[model samples]
Target: MELTFLVYDVIIQVYAMLIRVSSLFNPKARLWVNGRKGWRQSLKNKVPAGGVDIWMHCASLGEFEQGRPVLEALRSLYPEKCILLTFFSPSGYTVRKDYPIVNHVCYLPLDSRKNARIFLQTIKPKLVIFVKYEFWFHFIREISKQQIPLLLISALFRPGQLFFRSYGKVFKQSLLSYNRIFVQDKNSLDLLKNTGIEECVIAGDTRFDRVLTVMEQSKEIRAIDTFLQGKSAWVAGSTWPPDEQVIRGCSDLISKWIIAPHEIKEDHLLYIEKLFGEKTVRYSILKDAPEKFTDKTILLIDNVGMLSSLYRYGQAAYIGGGFGSGIHNILEAGVYGIPVVFGPKFQKFKEAKDLIYLQGAFSITLENELKDVIVRLGNDLFSKSAGDICAHYVHEHAGATEKIIRFIQEKRFLTN
Candidate 1:
């Protein structure tokens, strides 16, 4: 264990150094490095002394959404407790730093023994919750040492993950630090139990509850409505260049298109405009001059924080990122009862796999496959059937948030 800790420390140091170097060229990395600067002082100033804090850490914006339902529930249940939310990635922190629910939001410093100890000492949280795949050894160990109630929520475990491997004893031992692990699926529970770590339960995914809430709270975007003009469009969300290439090839099949690319930088926006030609109009421009874009068929969303709501404006949706790593959130669109299409690399996401099996979603590699799926979804009967599957799937998976909250109350993790 000592040797493993030494190796882990070396790896963490190397990773920190890499991030520092990468900050020179990478915008995200720059934000990451800069966010941690004077983190101790920042915590001291923001987090009040002697108040009970419930700390939740998310790796990125996605995990934040997954844990949001529980956070909101906790807020309603225990309004007196301070909610300190931390993000490991700038992608999460930059977007949600001003999130209204949490009392404070800040960047989690790099996972070093010293940083973890100092951070825990400063906050002195009564409960610590880690969303999804965050398993920082030092942070978990420090929290456990302090005997703070630590919970891992909306967690998923795959057979190929490090925790199940022979060399993963050190990593596996970290799981014991958590007071309870609320997993997203039964497979995760089974895997943990098989490994002799029994403090876990299948609480489904809180994102299901989140999407449903979002759907209920969603308001109309006048520009999107004007662009579609009663014509049903297909929304391509979080698209990469590869996803765009495929969409471009099948452009003729799609009547009205709404594309929300993953990166909305000037270069990427210009690239999308060029790729889609003159027919493409930016959402910002369309909002100001809706009449000028009356003839434009492709509406490009060159922004963030709107993709989830934008899914409602489409008859079908294509979630991107599958061609590169994996697909972005399909549930956001699926909850809207739309047939979702994505690239072939979706093995890691259990929701994607479930949707595909239920015929609610389609995974395609080639442009022709995309065209075919688009055409198939154009059929009202087929589209409705597939769409029903998606909506039902989302609704069925709801209440994970409630389950997690019930457990916390039952276990007395948080006092009233």
Candidate 2:
């Protein structure tokens, strides 16, 4: 089984290298994937390195955010230690390559035995933390062999997953290597114990911590502030076409709207612009707009990395991805005291159900019902009630980050 897994890892690595060739056409991307090691290494060692090295790995952008607060919490609690972040996806690594807190941010080389051995030798992290749903057997076993303390942050489990299946002994054994399992919910804890693993605790989600930190950074958000101009704005984040269609149906005469599509390709943006025509304004065209944009009916945020913070400016947020599309994080909007609306399909997300039970969130399967909900929000009483409900939901659900951090600290997992 181990040898077969190693062979599969080599194949995946070769495929990833082939994808790097796409960087030739996109030079900036080429630079990131190709020069990751030497360039990143040179910049990282300038910091003092003799202390404890805590290494955290995540699979992609969502996992990165899920693990971010823990990373920042570690830095604050243990300034003497060096932190290293390993991302298996180029999308996550490239977007976050410049984070100052991470001493080394690079690709988690494919988990072949040879590559895993080399990685363990290179950073030699005293502790390895894997963020939610990113368990690779080869890497887990190899890291465990070094007797490094392993922690799983914001881990979540469902019955349908391999770990719960009848033939899951191999994968279940891989999880046994963890010093502790910090699951996100009671459901996950139930699943883990059913598999005969007991080292589990409920730590909620670290993304809540990350969203709170983003709120702190947005305390003086001048850009989104000007765009909002005291009018009720709808901050649509990480949206797909189904979401856009629903928002368009209701936003024709609304006071203000912000449409940030997931894709920024020329064709995509132009299609979006035509959907609303002159009523829309792109951020790139802000230079040509009058000094003030109080009259701007719709502002299209055409760039990436700014949508989550922009949610702070919204009166009510409609998080895109649902219906047939995968759902985006509605908690980000909910944390800022705004009621979040999304598509009908959200079975995998426990937070969605909790938020709905709290009346902080709403979802619709039908397009026509969306209009009624929007019109209802026009009432001052309904809007205030929704906002207050959402804020209360956020307040009640915080402190997961502290729980996970305390677990790692009490274990004395990270060395100095």
Candidate 3:
């Protein structure tokens, strides 16, 4: 076991070194390497001596969004404790590095004994919270050794994961280091219980709360209204090339289509413009002249941060990324009381399944199937029924944030 641990440590080091070397050419890798430069000292400067440090670590943007509801609740419930947020990926840190509630946001030091020791000693957090599936052995071991309360929130588990395999004893042992684990479903709870690990609670997914918050705080975009021109539109959000192909096929049936592609590179924008030539107009171009957008039938969203709010303007939505891995946030569209449609690769998502069961969302395998579903949902009566189902489903699944917060208060994990 000791030899196995040493091998794992060396492998982690090698991976980090490779990423650093790749930083010279790869822009994303460069961001990862450059973001960590002098991070330790930067963290030291922000965190004061003897202050009550409450640390939360997330893997990336998705994990950060999942953990946001809990973090915000903690901030409101315990105001005195300084909140320190860390991310393992550059995507998460770069998007939320300037978050107002967090006192400091920095990249997590690589998982090594020396790095862990230095980080734990410098930050000295009373409680450490990991969002989703971040299970760093060295960090967990160090937190256990220092007697700091380590908790994981919004976790999900499956039978096929390595932790359940025959040679996964070490990985299973890592799970024991967490003081408590809050899962998102009963299946995850059962999975943990079957492994003889009983310190877990099914607190539901915090993203339901997150999407509700998004719905409440959504900004009204005037240009979207002009583009709609009182016509019900179909929104295709976080779309990739494959998703674009499907949308292009059935776009003639849908009067107004909002294309919010995942990648907004020049090549992608040009492709979209050519695909719907003379019918498409960029979002940035509509800022000065909102009236000019009324004539255009396709509103191309060539920027980030607007996709979430833009869902509200659509009567039906198609969430992208299903042709690749799983799907993007279906709940983002579902929360706005709209029927959602996606590709065949959505079985992994619990919300997608639930929404489908509720008859609020549909999955299509081909362009013809997409067109059929869209035509069916285009009706006034059918669309209202589906929209109502979505609204009820979103409202029913809220309050996971309160459950986790109540547990923290009962355990008295806060300090002045």
Candidate 4:
């Protein structure tokens, strides 16, 4: 066991060194390295010395979204306690560093034994919650050693993950350190149980709850409403170049498109403009002069944080990132009661599989497949039916947040 920990510590140090080297040229890597500078003093200066603090850590923006509902719930329930939200990736912290619900938000320092011990001693967190797949060894060990109540929420596990492998005993021991694990599905629970890890329960997914909340509280985007002008359009969100290429090919079938690319840098935006040609106008420009782009067929979303609300204006939606790692968030669109389309690489997402089986979503590999799906969705009755299914599926899986909060209350994790 000591040998395993030694090797793990070495790997962590090497990884940190690599990031420090990469920071010279890579902007994201630079942000990662810079964010942790003077993290110890930052925590000491910001976090009060005597109050009870609840710490929640997220790996990135996606995991932060999954954990947002619970964070807000805790804030409302325990207004007296201070909340400290930490992010491992700059993508999450940079965007949500000013999130109003939590008392403080900062980057989580690298997981070394000394860093972990100092962090825990500084914050003296009453409870620790890690969202999804974050299982830092030193942090988990320190939390366990301090007898802090640690919970893992909205977690998913697969047969091929390290925890189930032969050489993963050290990683598996980290799982044992969590006091309670709330998973997103039965498969994850089953996988943990098969390995004799019993402190787990199936709590569905809190993302569904989060999306539903977004939909209910969604504000009207006047620009989108003006752009659509009561006409039906398709929303393509977090789209990549490959996804855009497919969408471009199916342009003849769909009349209007609102495309939000994953990377909105100058080069990628220029590429998208070239692909879509003269009929495209950026949302930023269009909003400034809505009358000028009335005839444009493609409205490019050149900003972030609006994709979730944009789905309400479309007859159907296309979620991207499938042609690369996996699909982006389909629930964001599905919650709007719209038929969703994506590429063929969506097997990892349980919501994608469920929606596909229910005919609320479609997976396509080529232009012809997308064209066919779009044509089928053009039928008002069929579109309505599929939309209904998508919305119903999201609604049915909506209570993961409630379940988690109930457990926390019952266990008195927050009580003195």
Cα lDDT over the full model 2: 0.78
Model 1 misplacement above 4 A: none
- Cα lDDT tens digits, model 4, 1-416, are 88988998999999999999999999999999999999999999989987346999999999999999999899889988889999999999999999999989999999999999999999999899999999999999999999999999999999999889999988998899998999999999999999999999999899999999999888998877777787789999999999999999997677789999988999999999999999899998999778677799999999988999999988999999989999999999999999999999999999999999999999999999999999999999999999999999999999999999999999998888
Candidate 4 colliding pairs: none
**72-175 per-residue lDDT for model 2 (tens digits):** 88898888777888787767887887888877676776566766775676677888899998887778888889888898989889888877787666678888
> Model 3 over residues 1-416: C-alpha lDDT tens digits?
78867988999989999999999999888989898889778877988877446899999999999899989989887776788999989888888999999888889988989889988888989889999899999899899999898889999998999899998888898888888899998999999999989889988889999999999999988778877888879999999888888989998998899999988999999999988889899999986687977888889998889999999999899999989987899889989999999998998899899989889999988999998998899788999899889888889988889988888877787743
User: What is the number of backbone collisions in each predicted candidate, taken in the order shown?
Assistant: 0, 0, 0, 0
Q: Using TM-score as the measure, name the better of candidate 3 and candidate 4.
A: 4
lDDT (Cα, 0-100) at 209 in candidate 4:
91
Alpha carbon lDDT of residue 286, candidate 3? Answer: 80
**Which candidate number would show the highest lDDT if scored against the true structure?**
4
Which residue pairs overlap in candidate 3's backbone? none
Candidate 4 stretches with Cα past 4 Å from truth are none
Each candidate's TM vs. the true structure?
0.97, 0.88, 0.97, 0.98
Please report, as a residue range, the 10-residue window in candidate 2 with the lowest summed lDDT: 43-52
Q: Which should have the higher TM-score, number 2 or number 4?
A: 4
Per-residue lDDT of model 1, residues 103-197, tens digit only: 99999998889999999999989889999999999999999899999999999989999889999999999999888999988888999999999
